[model samples]
Target: MNHDRSHALFTRASELLPGGVNSPVRAFKSVGGEPFFAQRAQGPYLFDVDGNRYIDYVGSWGPMIAGHAHPQVLDAVARTMRDGLSFGVPNPLEVTMAEAITSIVPSCEMVRMVNSGTEATLSAIRVARGATGRSRIVKFEGCYHGHGDSFLVKAGSGALTFGLPNSPGVPKALADLTLTLPYNDFEAATALFDEVGIDIAGLIIEPIVGNANCILPREGYLQHLRELCTRHGALLIFDEVMTGFRVALGGAQQRYGIAPDLSTFGKIIGGGMPVGAFGGRRDLMRQVAPSGPIYQAGTLSGNPVAMAAGLATLELIQAQGFHDALEASTHALCGGLEAAAREAGVAFHTTRAPGMFGLYFREGPVESFADALGSDAAKFGRFFHAMLERGVYLAPSAFEAGFMSSAHSEADIAATVDAARAAFAVVAAA
Candidate 1:
């Protein structure tokens, strides 16, 4: 467990980067260790700068669906790079990428690609507000929509990991306009809608809730949200940054059978590239930029490399039986983890929404952010270190979800399960 190289790099990074990490969660405060620096990654494996290799269950925060450095994505990026990197102008590849996304995700009739998930959600908020002609937006507790000022309130993931649910710089006026509600509470949702339904411009939610670890919509939850919004004249925005293309080809909406007015997408769509997009009904989307009055634009949004990578990934996903195979692999991995933990006498809870899964060191099931907090985080911390020591990498925090990719082999899944069995024993006995 000699992380001296990582420590040294962290020290150097601190002088230049905030908290020695570009992102807050990477600080590794949750797992109680210096963050390992990645040097190289291949399918299912991450080689750290300290020369340690770990099975990467984090998958670069759920972007590496085809697994790290997929040959197809690499080849596409290389070919696109030869033509050019960024032109700061239109490219034919952008058209192809947009077409691919619109064709796959039903909600996205027209999409605007952005550089990151935060940008996608932020721009979608603008679009929603403009289309609805109202100022207030409602977000849910523990459903992270990105770091935009409006979304920074009561957020999840890195914001929760760092103990800053609401960052300081956001204006109180802006925060006031944004309301935070609890997930899976139809009564709470409708109550708010009744209270300020007309004043509220839109409601953005994570249909499957991945940030507080894969919390699925209970019973008639999504349909309720959709119906309530439509009945109250408020728009429904689905922040599918994690669930999009990972949960299903049509994302959470298709998986759950509820279509949102607007949807934000990221992760696997770009095949490990920096990409995000937001779209919905064509008339609603026409509110953006050149189409209408609402303003949103990007410089390197449709970069040739990113577009090419995304196009290749989408093509592969649609090519004969990919989703079914990916689901079977994910089911095996999650089932094996559950069995291994049980055999090791561990009080662990597991939940999944397709390829994404969440593990908790708790006795009962978790359905909400409050329920997710009931997990034995101390136990999770020890389990994280145990797995990392055994060369099986997991998400650095208990709140983040774990992902299984199509590229993960049966042997890799078995190794991950075996490591979890040993790690569970270590934590349970302690």
Candidate 2:
């Protein structure tokens, strides 16, 4: 529970890094505390510089599906790095990665690897615009597709956590081109497409809406979007960075049984390494460089080390009942937390999809951005610190989703529920 070393590190970091963290939410500004500096991570626990260990649910923002520092992933990295870090040319591992992605998600006939989710999304949008010869793109409120200029408008995650959904530097011109829609609202989508379908190049969405605290698509909602896009000639892009391989082997698209025109992937695809990819039907992907007119390039796009690590993780997850077990863990964790909240007489709800979940300080049925926003952020902030104090780490911001890993066991869940039992009492008292 002592964060003395962590505090000292933050003091030094504050002088160098903006907000004392590389990522915005890590500052814990929304949660009302300083962030803990991790010394090491093993299995499902994060060890801080103060030597305090925690049951980590952030899972490196959704990539550590197997767990932190899994031997398989580490060994893959060690072996791959021995050859060289970057080749400035094609590597066999990259080919293996591409094949793995395309095979797992059949919708991606061809995929382009990128350095980060932001890059993958930006490139996908460009492809959308270029392929269709249209100007506007559609994104939903409370859905974040990385920090690209086109995606910053009405964004989620850190933007929502800090109450700045629209960042300042994004130009008004660019903002105008990025249209926003309410998530899980079928009528709004139909109306918007009717109004601007001609000018719309693509409609990008996080089918699972992880940034908005894990809002699942309403029944048949994804099909409606697919139909609209098909009729209007606007490509449908699934930004599955967090959900890809985490929600299911084929991701949310697979779970939901929808095939998008374009798909962007990150997180688990890189297995905790910095990597991303976007692909879809061959004809559309063929338009992106070295094949057609549109150009997108990265010197370290398919870094061998990253590819090897990701491939290894993918192999582990492919084991029989991997996702089934992960899904059960999510249900168990959420059910226990809800029970603890009920016992404490605190209003609470949780939304889950396979390995990812959301915690809300409100009632159930959180199906839209507004519903997620209605959760009491202030109350959740208090609970966050209380849980952290008891050796459990949740996402720093209430707006971000929590992730579960294969490394987590029944004992870990029991200990977490025990922590929450006390934490919820703290919330009830507050």
Candidate 3:
């Protein structure tokens, strides 16, 4: 519990890096505390610089599906590093990665690699606009598709955590072109498409929203979007960066039985490394860069090290029963926490989709960003600190979803529930 070393590091970091962290949420601003610096991570736990051990549920923000430091992923990265790091040129590993992703997710007939989720989404929007010759884009409230300028309107995750839905630097002209709608609301989407469908270039969504704490689309919701886009001549782009391999092998699209015109992937694909991709129908993807004239390029798009790590992670998740087991574990953990909250007489609600889950300090279902806002942020902050004190590390912001890893065991879930039981009592008393 002593974070002396971490405190010292943060003091120095605050003078150097903005907010003393590379990422905003990592500063623990929403949770009312300084962040703990991670010394190392193993299967399902993070050992902090202060020597406190915690059962990790964030999974490095949804990329460590096979868990931290998996031997296979490590070995693959090590082997690839022996050859070289960044080629800035095409590598065979990149081709293999493309093949692996295409085989798993049928929607991605061809893919272009990028360094981060933001790049993948930004590039995807560009392709959609170029291919369709439209200037407007549509996104849902509380659904985050990285920090691209067009996506900053009503953005979730870190933006929501810090109360900055609209950042200062984005131009009004650009913001005016991006439309926002409510997720799971079919009538609003239908009405909007009817009005300006022709001007809309693309509609991007997180099929299973993780940024607003794992809100699942209502029954027939995704299908409705697909149909609307087809009718409107707008490309349906699924941003599956967090849910790609974690929700299911083929992702939310496969689970929902809906195929989008384009898709963006990140997190699990990199296996803890920094990587991302955007792909879709051969005709649409062909319009990008050297293949055609859409023009999207990256110097480290297909870094050998990233490809090797991604390929290995994909291979491991493809094993039989991988998703089934992960889903069951997530269900178990969420169910246990609900029971704990009930026994503690606390108002609590939770939602789960395969390996991803959310916790809310409110009653009943949370269906959208508006509903998510009703949850008690201050109360959840107390619960977060309580659990952290009990050796369980959750996503610091209440707006962020918690991820379960294949590396997590029943014991870890059980220990987490026990901690939650005690934490809920503290919140209830407050």
lDDT of 3 by residue, 67-173 (tens): 89999999999999999888777899999999999999999999999999999999999999999999988888889888788888754342112123389898877
lDDT of 3 at 1: 79
* Candidate 1 per-residue lDDT over residues 1-430, each given as its tens digit: 5678888999999999998999988998888988889989999899988888888888999888888888988999999899888999999998988888888877779998898899999998898899989998888877888888887875433211212337889876788788877888777887778888888889999988878877888988999999999998889999999999878888888888988999998877788889988989999998899989999988888888888888888777776777788888878988898888889888888888777888888876788899999888899999999999999988889999988877789999899888988898999889
lDDT of 2 by residue, 1-430 (tens): 7889999999999999999999898999998989999999999999999999999999999999999999999999998898889999999998999999999999999999999999999999999999999988888888998888888875433211212237879887788788888898888889888888999999999999989888999899999999999999999999999999989999999999999999999989888999999999999999989898999999999999999989999999999999999999999999999999999999999999999999999998899999999999999999999999999999988889999999999999999999999999999998
Report model 1's TM-score to 2 decimal places: 0.96
Q: Which pairs clash (backbone N, Cα, C closer than 3 Å) in model 1?
A: none
Which parts of model 2 have CA positions greater than 4 angstroms off? 155-165
Q: Which scores better on lDDT, 1 or 2?
A: 2
Global CA lDDT computed for model 3: 0.91
In angstroms, how far off is 138's CA in candidate 3?
A: 0.1
lDDT of 1 at 259: 82
Whole-model lDDT per candidate: 0.85, 0.92, 0.91
TM-score of each: 0.96, 0.97, 0.97
